[model samples]
Target: MINGPNFVKGFRVTKVKEFSLTKPKPRTIPVPQKIPTQKPHQPVPESTYRSPKEQEVLQGKKLTNRQKAEELLIEANMEQFKCANPEKSEKTKRVLSEIMREEDNKMAFNKVKVQHAPMKVDNVPVRLNAAAILRERALYQRQVEEELSRIEKLVDGARDPSEFLEWQRQMHARDLEKQLADIECRRLEGKLSREEALLARQNLIQENKKKALIKKEETEKLMRVYAEKRLQEEKEMRDLVEQVSEGHKNTKQARMKLQKYKQQIVQEVAEESRELLRQALEEAQEELRKKFELIREIRAMESVPFIRQTLVDLTQTAGHGLNCEMSIVELRERLALLKEAERKAEEEKRDQILEEKQLKQQHLLDTLEQISLHRAAQAKAAVLRLEEKKSKSQLGKAAIANNDRVTELQRKLEEKMTERKRQAEALKLNAQRSTSKSCKNSYEEKHWKELEESRERQAQLLQYGVVSGETANRMAAYQAARNGTSQAYVMPS
Candidate 1:
């Protein structure tokens, strides 16, 4: 049976081979050889190409099929070739079709079948066990709930979250919630990642806003402090200005007072200098007076000595006979005469002084008389005017009163008149005595006569042409004559 099976199996295999060989092979279409087509230098115009709407529908289509018939003909330069060789036109067309088919096949073969890498899930650090994930989610939920509660309390109280005393606790809770949300979202299918990122960004933006608010409040506080400080400084400056003004006023007053004091001191010094100068001048005048007095005393002493010596010389020169005796007597008489002459000279000087005193007294009397007359006239005028103003009754009483006062004034006037008359009489007597006394003394007269006699004798001697003896006798005779004449002229008293 095994052999029979083997023979059958072998017969089937041979029959399969005979059929495979005997069956006519299907005709295989020959693949065309590729000929490179020259690409156009310029892009085809939009009008000659498929519209965008059509291109979308015909995406991945052949450019030859999509191009206008005229564009294809122009690109291929088929018109010129057809015109030149009409017989080869169909063959060229077939060749071109075969070339285009070959190009299409090459493009199809070059096309990459890009299977996108299987969409990968990012490996998060979080464990993927459901129980652990759920437990962590619950914990994050509790934290979020706590953060929510704190934020709600802050909002209700109108307090800033950033300023909260427990702000760190809130921040930790928010971080936990954010991590949990990120992990959970990543684990979920079809979750929008953009939403998760946006939520985190929004939280960060809120934190930045809180920081900015704090900074703004601090800036406002600083500005307020600066303004108050500036106000205080300005006030101080104003006060200082006022103080300076007051000090300036005081300084001005003090300067004025100092100037006045300086002026007064200068005046005092000037006055003292003037007074000292006056005292020095007075002292100089007193010293000059003393020197003048001393000079007068010296002159008087000198005159006394000269006069005594002259008297002694005159006495010694005369001699002793009758003639000598006469000469002696004459000399004695001359000495007596000299004594009288000296007495007369003194009397004449005294008379001259008396005359001058009388003249001065007379002048004083005249001036007094004139003054009295003027006063009398004034009194008369006053009396007349007083009488005119008086009433009849008053006039009577006034007349009595005036009579008594007038009597008193008249008594005084009479007394003054009597004194004046007495003084005038005394002055007249003294003047008379002085003139008579001056005439009676005759010393100066005698001296002048002697000198004249001497001159006349000399002239006489000259006229006579006398010898010495004759001259002596003539002189003696002349002297005797002169003495006789002088004796005759002498006063009898």
Candidate 2:
């Protein structure tokens, strides 16, 4: 390294660090990424505009600007299918599809485009990703690990194979031969011809001298450039600091002016409000004084005779006299009459109250009587229902018993018919033994007696439920009875 000259004050030489212009090898070890355990709390942003096609398809889905633009292009292309037959418009569809594909390609390129950070006054600062970066970093690390694992497995597998090992061994054997050749040359050193040694020294001296001169020139040029750049940066920083101080001063002045103006406005409003309140108070006091003065004037005029006296005097006594309080006798007479009228009014009021009380009592009695009557009617109705039920049951039993009696009577009548036949034969013999006139009279008399007995049996049978009681049939039977003969009715078989 070369030192600076002593003539320059405060300009000591510094050994600058050497920086290689070639790019550095990328790091192999991956940094561990932290996985998030919870969802992000921040809200996502949405686009303000959308295409009609997306509006129809998305329903409620939010879209980005790029997505909306893509949908709009697709919608325009699809409209051709509606206006023309798909078969006829195949060429048009193909052209639209081509246009759509190009737009999609452009959009895809923009989506993957690399974005560079804006440059600062000092330098372009590197941007740090939020939590999403950790996830991406983890994914990248996983891919790298997979590749490394694959390579390791391939190498490990190749090392075991006999053919692969033979190839590697061949390559290593060539390298070993070169190393042996180098060792032999080192062992054969320290012995050279006189002319050969002198020529090698001369060549070495010339090469070193040329390299040292070139290195010195290059170092000087690099140092000059570094010093100029540093000075320019220092000047810019100082200017920026001065500008910040000036801005602060201007802000302070503006704040003072704003505060002063606010105070003036507040004072003006307070003064105006106070002035309005004072004016209202003065008007109220003036109105109160005017009202008091009017009252005072009215009182002073009341003592005048004309103001006190009036033509339309409305004070009148119930007596014939014009004065009401002329003497005690007149007053006493009027008071007695008023007392009599008050007594009569009191009596009338008492009568009205007593009449109202009597009417209330009568209404209460009437309601109580009606309620009692209703309850009695309900009890009677319940008793009647029970009686009807008992009567129906009894009637049912009687009808059943009467039906059995009728069956027994029918059986007995059949037996009686046989006995009557034998009796009739005996009667016929007795009649034949008598004279012809006597026989005829006896037969007629005996027939009438049998008819009367049959009528009585029929009436009894009706009471026993063997026959029905009908008014019209009863009338015919009564007419037959009055004529002293039996009337036969043909019963349906």
Reference-based lDDT, residue 67, model 2: 67
The true-versus-predicted C-alpha distance at residue 265 of model 1, in Å, is: 64
Give the per-residue lDDT of model 2 (tens digit) for 1-493: 2686567457768899878877798879988899869976876545535456766544433334446668879997776432122354567889999999999988885677567443223344545333334444455557669879878988877444568877986666555545544443332231122223434555575587689889999999999999999999999999999999888876877899999999999999999999999999999999999999999999999867665555642354445666434455666788999999999999999999999989866665555555456557669989998997686556544544455434554455445445545655665575576578777898889877776675666667666777665743675477567657777762221
Model 1: per-residue Cα lDDT over 2-43, one tens digit each: 556453233433344344677788999999989999986997
Give lDDT for model 2: 0.66
For model 1, state the Cα shift of residue 108 in Å.
Answer: 99
Tell me each candidate's RMSD, in Å, in order: 89.5, 75.4
Q: Which number leads on lDDT?
A: 2
CA shift at 128, candidate 2, in angstroms?
A: 99
In candidate 1, stretches whose alpha carbon ends up further than 4 angstroms from where it belongs are: 1-403, 441-493
* TM-scores for candidates 1 onward, in order: 0.16, 0.16
